[model samples]
Target: MNWYVVYTKPKWEKKVAERLNQIGIECYCPVITQIKQWSDRKKKIEGPLFNSYVFVQLLDMDRNAVFQVAGVIRYLFWLGKPAIVKDEEIAIIKKGLSDSNVSDVSVTAFQVGDRIKLESGVFSSQNAIVQEISNTHYILVLESLGCVLKIKYK
Candidate 1:
């Protein structure tokens, strides 16, 4: 079986993953917990790490099964075909999130136009360019992934 990426409706990653699992479809929706502050109080909440995205492992013939779940929009496509994520990549994501050493990870500032290799975190081992930076977040262009990531920080 191969792992395929599924795109979900906005903020539906977790729900879609849960529904897929309930129907015996193996899926993965990586999540993270963070503190959210309200005007009156602060609380910890868990949210999908990659917004609107989930990974499912299944045979190509079973691809249509995922559509039965609500909020699943479609399979992500790359180069005119369903985007396939390697098993090793999935394993690495799981391992990185589970590793205790990653708990203390922090973001550092980078000069615009600097080429950098990510050492850890979700895009670990990937090369990216510091495209832009602002007070709240920074943008990174991961050429290999063919995506621009805008990461926010305190």
Candidate 2:
């Protein structure tokens, strides 16, 4: 089994997942929790990590079977070759998602002395040491400042 990208029809992401499940195609669609505001109050819900594409694992021979699923527009490919996601990367992502022995609030772990770089933000392309880590922020000691900087970067 290998990972392949599936293109869903307009506004049919969930429908495609259901159809694929019915036909026994293994798929992965990670969702993040979000809060929705209504007139009176707000409610929490899960939303797709990606808007229109989902990953599926299936045998190479099941090409036609995949295209038959409702709401599946097509398999993304290049030069007649199916787009493939590496199994190792998929395993890492799944393990991170399914860690039961963890805190209620997800906290990304960072090494205190590990060298790291950031891109696209106020500190774009800056290297720093992770001095401390919070649930939603990184307390990094910038190379230039030599003092700790509390950055709310994901």
Candidate 3:
């Protein structure tokens, strides 16, 4: 059985994983506990590490059954084929997420022209491309909205 990535509907990662498991399909949806602050209080919430993607371990024959699950949009493909994720890489992600010292791992080395998804703030879930990088912040260009934003990472 190889691990393949499935894209889920918005905010459906956890639910889709549960449904797949009920059908005897091994699924993984990595989540992290985050402290969200508001003017009145702070609360810890669990959220998906990758917003709309879930990993499933299954034989190629089981692909049809996986697609039948509600909220499962489609498989992430590469070069006209379904992308396969290695077991070792999945294990590393699980281990790193479970480690107490693992606060934040850089998803990618940000380079100019690389597209990125905003994980939080008012522009949460928006896509932008890196226009420039400074010592402390990134200058991103939101192409669809025709605007640029400077974001600082903590």
Candidate 4:
């Protein structure tokens, strides 16, 4: 069985993952705990790390089994086919979340020449220099990865 990326309805990642697992399908929905403030109080709430996305592992023929659950939009596509997530990538996410050494993960505004180190994801620990910035995204030149990365934000 291979891991495939599943796109879910907005804010449905955790619910969809729970439903898929209830039916015996292996699913992963990474979550993070943050302090959310309202007029009354500041409370710690857990939320999905990747909004509207979950990972499911199943055989190619068993792919349709996920659709039986609610809020599953579709398999994320790449190059006209369902996008696959490598097992190592999934492990990285799990390890990052479990490792207490990793902290303060945030997407903040960066200047054109600021140097930053990625705290999570595939590029964790890699140093990148900001090359460009915009309202919705930023470009980084990852020296160690030897690649230019464009990250979209809102």
Q: What is the C-alpha lDDT of each candidate?
A: 0.90, 0.75, 0.90, 0.89
Error of 4 at 92 (Å): 0.6
Worst 10 residues of 2 by lDDT: 100-109
- 34-91: candidate 3 lDDT, tens digit per residue: 8889999999888899889999999998887888799999998855689899999999
Better of 1 and 4 by TM-score: 4
lDDT (Cα, tens digit) per residue for candidate 4, span 1-154: 8999999999899999999999999999998888899999999889988888899999999999999999999998865689899999999899988889876444344689999999987888999999998876789999876999998754
* TM-score, cand. 1 vs. native: 0.70
Query: Lowest-lDDT window of 10 residues in candidate 4?
Result: 102-111
> What clash count goes with each model?
0, 0, 0, 0
Per-residue lDDT tens digits of candidate 2, residues 3-120?
A: 9988887667777887888889888876556778999999987656567777899889886787887778888774468889899878876786667663233435467776788776
- TM per prediction: 0.70, 0.58, 0.70, 0.70
- Looking at model 4, residue 78 earns an lDDT score of 63
Residue 81, model 1: lDDT of: 88
Error of 3 at 139 (Å): 18
TM-score of 3: 0.70
Query: What ordering of candidates by lDDT runs from best to worst?
Result: 3, 1, 4, 2
